[model samples]
Target: MYNPTVARLTYRALLGRRRALILFALPALLILMSVVVRMFVGVDDRVAAEVLGGFALATMVPLIGVIAGTGAIGPEIDDGSIVYLLSKPVKRSEIIITKLFVAVAVTMAFSAIPTFVAGWILNGNGQQIAIAYTVAALVASIAYSALFLLLGTVSRHAVVIGLVYALGWEALFGSLVAGARTLSVQQWSLAVAERIGTGDEITSDVGLPLATTLLVAVSVAATWYASQKLRTLTLAGEE
Candidate 1:
């Protein structure tokens, strides 16, 4: 249920000047941080792991996900423009899926690519750390896109809610609360990365099997729910 037109429009809005600035900002910072760390700290595998894992994976990925995911549909919904899209011939599900696809693409581009570059810069791909965390960023992108796109459909305050969840719950509480870590997208992605990484430094609280299952489940469930929400918006459009 893909729609090219829906995808094009979603891409335009997300990559528009303001949103593009936010999307690019983190990746730039990550690269700069990598350069700074490299110049000052020199090449140490542990330091590389600390920078990429602590800042890149933990902070950058989720924040970019929040921006890309929410910006995909939130603006359209907020300004009543979604009614125009809803009134079109496209099915509600197609619209939701298309937006989800765009969101995932943007998140991956802004996050996964830079993560690899930064990883390379940090340690010249030592211990496969660059590849490992890049894999994590890619996996994390899909789940975050679906989850935050669903948020866009349901809440006008989706961005705010996402920020709180990303910075507060994820980056903070996830480290402290064992239960919170289990439910986290970050942890789930890290599980996959843990396998790819050679050294013992890369770790995850959740096992790979459990992480894969949860990632797939969350992405599918969120996309399905967002489609349902848009179907109701179809009726709202007709009114």
Candidate 2:
């Protein structure tokens, strides 16, 4: 459902105002860090790996996912602007799917592309690091978008919950607890990167087949569940 009108509305809300700034900010920071690292350290593949893995994939991608995914519907639900779309004869599922598509595209564009650029800048694509991380970024984009979009549909504190999941769970506990890595998008996508990259350059706690299955399952299930949630979505009274 390529709803041009819904797509247009989603694009405007995504790129308009302060959210746009955050969208630009993450990639800008990545490029800036890449430039600084290249200038001082001079194109070390290991450094490239560190920057991309530590910052780009681990941090920026998830942050952008949070913004795009949650932002796609959270504000609409909050201010009750979703009523405009709901009042139309359009199926609520169409609206959710359309918004989900937009969110995934936005997340991929902002996170994955920049990750590739930063990867190349840091190491000139040595050992296929750029392409590998780029692939992971792309895969992660889909999952993160679906998860956060679902968060938007059901929770008022979508951004907060997303941040906690991204930062606290994935970033913090994932590092500390072995079990946490199994449920992490960061680790799951890293598994993809691991398959593409050279020995030990990219590693993931999760395996390739499991990560692939989980990634696909999570994306599909979240998107479907979001559509169902949107069907019966109710706006809170302005108490």
Candidate 3:
């Protein structure tokens, strides 16, 4: 269920000079930090969880998601290039689906792979910690892509709004308020990691069943809503 042309365009748009620098920078920082931490602290599971959870999962993933997801459609819509695609015979849903796929792939590649490498650097995959957090990064990528894709479709300020949600809400409020954890993408993804990792170092506020349900529901609903928005998209005349 992919359109190759749309996918290619989306990939190019996302991997352009500036955005690619941003996408690569965070993961590189994460790996660098992992190496430094390993040198200083030696291999410890607690340190591994803290680094992965605090920086990789909390900061890097959402930032990359915001860039990739909003970048997939926001620029096209802003520059009026989307009108050419809209005027075509292709289904609106196909365009959204293809772009969504591209965004998810980019997010996973930039975020998850580095997370795995960082985890390994931290503990050599001891107690399955590296693999567990890698799985969390993978799961988080899907939900973040769909949600930010919908934001890109509906708002010109998609990146700002995404940062607010990712940083202000998910990080700040989720730490301050206990109830906020239940509604967090980070927590839901952590739930998956918790189940996979044997150690108690990695944990989540949400349960497995509830987390899985929320993950699936958010991804499906966001994609559906984005496709619907695309179907009804309007182009304004330049006065």
Against the true structure, candidate 3 reaches a TM-score of: 0.97
Could you give candidate 3's per-residue lDDT for residues 1-239 as a string of tens digits?
68999999999999999999999999999999999999999999999999999889888888899999999999998898998888777888899999999999999999999999999999999889999999999999999999999999999999999999989877777656788989989989999999999999998999999999999999999999999888778433321
lDDT of 2 by residue, 1-239 (tens): 66778889999999997999999999999999999999999978788888998888888989999999999999999998888888787877788889989999999999999999998899889988999999999999999999999999899999999999888876677656898889989899999998999756888899999999999999999999998888767333321
- Provide the global lDDT of candidate 3 against the true structure: 0.92
Ranking by lDDT: 3, 1, 2
TM-score of each model, paired residue for residue: 0.98, 0.95, 0.97
Q: List the residue pairs that clash in candidate 1.
A: none
What is the lDDT for 115 in model 1? 95
Per-residue lDDT, model 2, residue 101, is 92
Instruction: Estimate the overall C-alpha local distance difference test score of candidate 2.
Output: 0.90
lDDT of each: 0.92, 0.90, 0.92
User: What digit string (tens of lDDT, one per residue) describes model 1 on residues 61-95?
Assistant: 99999998999999989999888887778888888
On TM-score, the stronger of 2 and 3 is 3
Please give the TM-score that candidate 2 achieves against the real structure: 0.95
**Where does candidate 3 stray beyond 4 Å?**
234-239
